[model samples]
Target chain A: MKILVCVKRVPDPETVIKLTPEGASIVTDNVKWVINPFDEIAIEEALRIKEKAAGTEVVLLSIGQKTAQEQLRTGLAMGADRAILVLTDQVVEPLAVARVIEKLVGTEKPELILMGKQAIDDDSNCAGQMVAELLGWPQATFASKVVLGGDQKGAQVTREVDGGLETLAIPLPAVVTADLRLNEPRYASLPGIMKARKKELKEIPLAELGVDVAPRTRIVKLETPPKRTGGRKVGSVQELVQVLHDEAKVI
Target chain B: MIEWSEQHELIRQTFRRFVEAEIKPNLRELEHGDTPPYAILRKLMATFGIDQVARARFERQIAREKEGEAGPGERAAGPEAADSAAMQLIPVIELCRYCPGMVTALGVSVGLTAAAIMSRGTLRQKERWALPLLTLETIGAWAITEPGSGSDAFGGMKSTARRDGDGGYVLNGSKTFITNGPYADTIVFICKLDEGNEPRERKVLTFVLDKDLPGLTRSRPMLKMGLHSSPTGELFLEDVRVGRERLLGETEDVPARAGAKQTFSQERAGVPAMALGIVSQCLELSVDYARTRVQFGRPIGEFQLIQLKLARMEVARMNLQNLIFRQIEMAGAGKRMTLAEASAAKLYAAQTAMDVALEAVQLFGGNGYMAEFQVEQLCRDAKVLQIYAGTDEIQVSQIARSLLRG
Candidate 1:
């Protein structure tokens, strides 16, 4: 079985982002980049599948610039068979990314496609579903648990719902979007990191894939959230109740 | 300009994540409670395939030794060797950032004890003892420091191995400040060879000892000023009998003096990593504390004195990191530091770490003095760097002696 996982490079969630002078985007200089948390879960699930089935090849695919090679190498280090980088510096929208992935799917012909439900940077949970729609394959999004059937003919995916889980059995050649509880990712060992450099990482431009790589949406303005102000203390319970009822008006 | 390659950076990140997940939660237990660090260290080795790597390296080393192409003290001649060494040291530095004691405990077992056997022991001895220590399957202790001996380890040494009748030896000694001494399954016991020689001129003979040997007594862990996570204890060998097989190299001709000195140098070289960890952590904590901690209606970081402390810490960290980088480069080039150079590095690193840790504590002010703050633990741990391996005074002497000779 061959499993292809699509990962993305984003600024670490822990980084204190700063806006550019023009307020268009974040200041990228000196910002540390890491694999999207959800994507890491996707990669972990792929690795788990590979572990269960012998000779199961796990390939990682990413769509970004040359620096994205770092995240690709990280995937390889986590025991991916190889990597494919859909090289582009342009900011591709969800639909364009899905199209690029569709092209790769045609060429690679993987039995399964796994990716994060959403990238943390944009929180756009559309790529996996859109790609599955484009390929006309079944998809299980928000997957917390994925169990392959006894005969390896299908998978039972448990999706994390509002207050419970929703399980669905998806046939082969399916796309699964990993949710937060999918699985905990394993660390890349020192030896694995060193050996990752020797693994195959093939890069191809978006043009070569023959996909319409145009953004369908434009980001109008980027701004940080309003600064949080310190709370004030009330003298007594009566005063606190009065303040809550009048000023806050919640009570 | 010590820059980590992408690979090295990735490895550091991996280790940092592992430490946070595996080691951080148990910080209190490991530091204050009776939790031994071996199990966690073993898990780390297994997680990173360190045991497999060590096994492969050992097999190759043994093969080279058999061919007589690589003898004891002979380093593998290559850049890869240095790169591999640097890779191995990365974890040490990372671990030290939070728990320096764990690194101390691990280094003693794998770095010092296993190395002692592999460098001087026969093939049978290596297979019997060194392999297990290297894999961390069985804890090992390199017992050299005695109650009577510290700086003058060989000269002031009172421990001795006497030539008993019928070719066996009777070992009698007491070793203090021995890392993993209490729980060591295997021990490399260094003592004077009683060949009826002058007290000051006895030959240093090293013997391989196992726990539960007749008349062997291992003490409980002693109270220490720092490095609480690493158990330090005492060992007493009262007329312990051992056959010729237990003797390192199976002969007295291979002087233990040279080998012990080499071990000291190796220990000295490793201090930079430990020191780097301590300094890096201290600086990080102090900076964060300065930014958030409010005093006089503003962040303490705005104060010039606190900024100066943080700045000096950064300087120390950079210097220590550069020292490690230089060591790595030389290691990659198949070169080892001279004893004098190792001493110089250790002295500077140890002093810098101690100073930085104290400054961090000062920056934290009263909170730093309290054990609740992590900086307090760091301060305690950093002081040991200057005391162990070789004390600051001893290092100064070693450096000065070399210069005088030159």
Candidate 2:
């Protein structure tokens, strides 16, 4: 069995983001980049699959500048067999990313494509669906539980839905997008990191993928969310109820 | 000036996350709930594959020792060794930021005890005792300090290991302030050889003893001002008989006295990283408190005195960081600090950490003094740095003596 997990490097969620001087993008000078949290779950799921199925090859696939190699190495440390970096600094939109991944699918020929439902950076929630559409393959998005079938030809996937879970048995060569409730990722051990330094990390230029690589969207501006005002304390239950009923209108 | 590369930063971040996840939640249990730190420390070792690395390193050392080769030098050398050393210390620094006691307990078991056997013990001894210790499969205590011998370990020593009628040694002594003492499965007891020599110039011998041997008694943990997470206790040996095989080198020629100095040097060298952790945490908390603590219609940061305190904390942090970087760079160059140099590093780093922590408490006012605040714990923990391994006064004396001799 072969699994290809698409990962992204994003600014650490703990960082206090600040806008650039132009207010059109975030300031990246001192920002720490980490493997997207959801992507870590995807990697964890892939590792679990590899553990269950003998001779399974888990390859990490990412699209970004050279710095993304750090995230790739981190994935490798988490027990991926190898890594592929689609090297480019251009802001590739969801469609272009899906196209590039589509090109990789043709070469890697992995039986399953595993990835986070969306990267936390843009939260577009479009790339996986777009790739699934481009490839015309079935996809199970927001997967909370995935159990490979005994037959090795299909997998039972439980997905997080509105107020409930939806289960589906998807055949091989499907896309599974990880949800927050997916298996918790393990810490990359020190020995694993040292071994990862020796693993194979193959870099392919975006142009070599033979894709259009053009963005279909652009950001007009970036602004901070409005600051929340301090809440007022009511002296009595009646006063609290009156405030919630009249001023807040949410009794 | 040296800095962490991308790889080093990644390692630091990995350990930082592990600390936040594993240690932060159980901190209260460890600090005040009578829970020992060994279990958590072992879990950390397994989680990080430190045990695997340590086992492999020991195997290599064992093979080398069998081939009549010298062990690897104490100092790290080359980029690989330096990186490996830094990786080991990252957890020490990160853990100390939240709980210095964990690092203390871990260092004694793995660093001090394992290094003791690996460096001086014969191959058979290493296989019997050191391997388990390095892997943290068994806890170890290196007992050198006696109730009477705090600063003058040799001159004021009272413990003795005498040759008995059966050609074995009978050990008699008590060791206090022993790390991992209460729960140590194996102990490396250091004592003077009672060979009819003058007390001050007696030969120092090291014996490896198990926990429950006849006449060996370990006290329950004593109340400590800090480092409570690391159980500190006393060990009393009343004529505990041990065979020649139990001797560290199976000979008295390998003086335990010399090994204790080397161990002290290693311990002193590690102080900077621990100090850096505590100082940096204190500074960070102080900065956050300054920015939000309102007084006289403005944040306390607006006041010049508070600003000065914050500024000094920053200075101390910078200097400590640079000192640690220098140590790493030196290790990369395959250089080890002289005993005096290590002492100087410990002295300055310990003093700086103590000053910064005291100022942090002052900045927090009553809140800082209370147990609720982290700086209060940090302040108490930082004081041990000045006392243990060697006191600030001892470190100063060591540095001055080297200068005077030169």
Candidate 3:
């Protein structure tokens, strides 16, 4: 079985985030890049699947600027066998990335594609589902448990929903998006890191993948949510209940 | 106190996982039952490379030269350069001191097993036998002890080796309480060369015997009180005829007088590092347990009693760690100690390990005495520290004797 896991490169979680002067993007002048925390869980899942079920290969797929190559290398160091860097200097939106990955999946013909539900940096939880739609494949989003189906062409995915947890038996050629509760990602050892430098990394440009860089949503401004002010307190429970019912109107 | 560089941190994490998965869980059953953790211990042999010592030695040599402490462009270690050997032994000592069983298994499996081939075997012998010992393909036993040969390991050795027809040697020996002897594929059997001569000077001969060789017999595992995971057993080398290729150090009559001098010097160097490792292990066990275990109102770690124990453990640990390193450096730099100095470090560190481990158990109280607790295992394991690699009494004797000679 061939599995393609889409990974993202994001600023290290240790680095505090701050907005730029225009407030449209982040101020990432000098911050360490790491595989997104959620993506790490996705990578671990792919590796575990390949380990438990024999004759499987995990190919890391990442889309961003050139630094995405470094992120892909990080995945390779953590035991991914192969990597594909989808190149684009343009601010590639989630739908565009999803389309690109879908195109790559069509070329590779992987049995399953796994990715994080969303990148922590952008908080755009749309790529995995969009790719599933583009390829007309079943998607298991926010997946915490994945058991291979008896038929080999399907899987039972357990994930969270609005009110409670749910399970979905999705057929093969499926896309899986991970949540935080999957598995802890292992750090790459020195030997693994050294070997990663010699791994098979194939870089396919955005134009080569034949997906156009198109943004469906444009943010004119980015601002913090307004803060709530202090509320007045009443002397007793009865008085507080009356105030809540009357002035506060929260009863 | 244990700080990992960014590069080593990854390896540390891997090793930590390895310990959790392989060592920590089974440490209880293995220690109590005296069942040697042969499989996992052997598996961990892959992690530490054989030439790590040589590499460390090389790095230390270069560092010292660059600092201009030694003469210009001098590659050879001189009398003034005894510090490098000890420095080279630092990592090994630190690693083993954390876990004595780990080092003992490694030493016997690799260090002792390679003894015969390294000391006297021919080029053919070394190339073939040495490789297996180095990679842990065959565990090796350095057979030196007899029922009565505790302190006088060589002086009282009862095992005998007689040269048989044409190029074969027949060795008859019963080596007791041999480390790795129960499981060793190769045995470096130390025997009496001539029964009539003075026992101390001309009687000893070290021979390498293969376990598969005929007439060789071994007892089942001996129940040990501590360091229980280290395989110990009685070995009966009953007229075992090993080929000429198996003999170590010197082929012709062993030249016992010369080899004894060299072996004692090497043993002196080796024992100190082993002692350092023991103390280091004790310190780690104490500190880690203190931090996690709670007492009245707060972590016992916050209490002055626990703090004092930890502080003393650290002091002992750091002192021995450096002392051993200096000894190694001294050996590497070609300034072998006058016997007394070597025994002093070993004596101090070994006693320190016993003391520290005892205090660690005290800190753990009732939990420390339990078989399940790590501190109890360590406490049991610490007993051997006082006994082996030269007993404390033997060390005191050697040092005092050496002082008299001075």
Pick by TM-score: which candidate is best? 1
Displacement of residue B107 (Cα, Å) in model 2 is: 0.6
Q: Which stretches of candidate 1 lie over 4 Å from their true place?
A: A16-30, A149-153, A162-166, A218-251
Say which candidate scores most in lDDT: 1
> Chain A TM-score per candidate?
0.93, 0.93, 0.89
lDDT digits (tens) for residues A1-251 of candidate 2: 88999999999998889998888889998788999999999999999988888999999999999999999988888789999999998988889989988999999999999999999988999888988899998899999999998877898999999999999998988999999999899889888887788899999999887899877677999989998999888899999999999998997
Worst 10 residues of 2 chain A by lDDT: A209-218
Clashing pairs in 1: B82-B331, B82-B332
Candidates 1 and 2, the one with greater DockQ: 1
Model 1 CAPRI rating:
medium
Clashing pairs in 2: none
Write candidate 3's Cα lDDT for B184-266 as tens digits: 88787777765456756555666767788889998887887777767788998777877676666546566654554454445
Clashes of each: 2, 0, 18
User: In model 2, how large is the Cα lDDT of residue B397?
Assistant: 96
DockQ of each: 0.67, 0.66, 0.08
Ranking by DockQ: 1, 2, 3
Per-model CA lDDT versus the true structure: 0.91, 0.90, 0.71
